[model samples]
Target: MPHKDTQGRRDSTGGVGGPRPQEGSPRGGLTLSKPSQRRTGRGRAEEELTRLVSEARLLEGLSDSLRDMVMRAQAYLAELRTAGSTLENLAGQEGVEVLVPIGAGSLVKASIKDADKVIVSLGADVAVEVDVEKAKEIIGNRLAEAQKALQDYVARLREVERALSAYRERIRSLLEERGLAGGPEERSK
Candidate 1:
């Protein structure tokens, strides 16, 4: 049983009518929760579905970003491999004509006057002159490291793809259960 106050306010906790509790009417008068505040079972399920769909979209964005990283890592690995190959081919070709890139895959004939030594960048705007063999070794090590990084990126992309796949399946199942399989896109298509 609840109590009423002078202003006719009801106390659901059976005290002097002070403030209404969040739910219930005064001792079984009616289910007096505001219609907007009242959540049906179906409404809660729909909310869950909405939340899942949003999470799937978020995961999809993450997957796209991971894919871009994988592509960049692959391109970097290819460039490192190409540089290593060029260095290996120049190992014993001092004072000979060689094709060198002017820009954008365009090569011009150039003479290797000093192929015995080369300037190797130690990164951060720092470079040191080293013999051809040492430069090649350094490039080889860099190539290996780049290859490993590429592998790591690819592995992470695969993991993201797998998670994206699972999310897609779950989203599909949820939609099908709600009779919204394929959603509006399918109908429009």
Candidate 2:
């Protein structure tokens, strides 16, 4: 029996298990051993693991930033809610009146007399002129300022949502690369 060497060429007097068989010996009685397989790399796997860890750290930082934004948005909403409640309470308060200009050299002042009846000031000697249109303009400007603040709050909320989405995408890719992604069953759970 003859066996090939590492170079694929047959050598003399060396067979299976380091011993040569006798000439014309029973061929079926010999046993052949297979070559051992080489193990794969460790360095490349380590590098991938390191990259995954760095990505996780970045994801955590983004999540923290998103949380801060959520807190700020909550504070802004609370402020808006408080402002709305204050406006409602002020409207419901006493001593509130709607004054309007009437005909030539005349004015009308309407105030909530009790709960049901509204009282109007009569044209008498105490009649005073007030620029009601200017007053409305001032109130409208203040309301516009409040509206701008509310719009800014909403814009900040959208920014928070955008940053959170980016972090989620990065984490998903990292988990997929490591074969650690929760499959359908895990997701359902």
Q: Evaluated with TM-score, which candidate comes out highest?
A: 1
Record all residue pairs in model 1 with backbone atoms less than 3 Å apart, i.e. clashing: none
Candidate 1 wrong stretches, greater than 4 Å: 1-27, 31-39, 183-189
Candidate 2 C-alpha lDDT tens digits along 1-189 = 667765565644467434445434586455333321111123444455566567656656765665675566566556545544443444344566855468797889886443322222224744433233433344455556656665665576566557656655765665665566688786566
- TM-score: model 1 vs. ground truth: 0.71
For all predictions, the C-alpha RMSD in Å is: 7.2, 19.8
lDDT against the true structure, per candidate, is 0.77, 0.53
lDDT at residue 54 of model 2 (Cα atoms): 72
Q: Name the 10 consecutive residues with the lowest summed lDDT in model 2.
A: 32-41
Stretches of candidate 2 above 4 Å error?
Answer: 1-40, 92-189
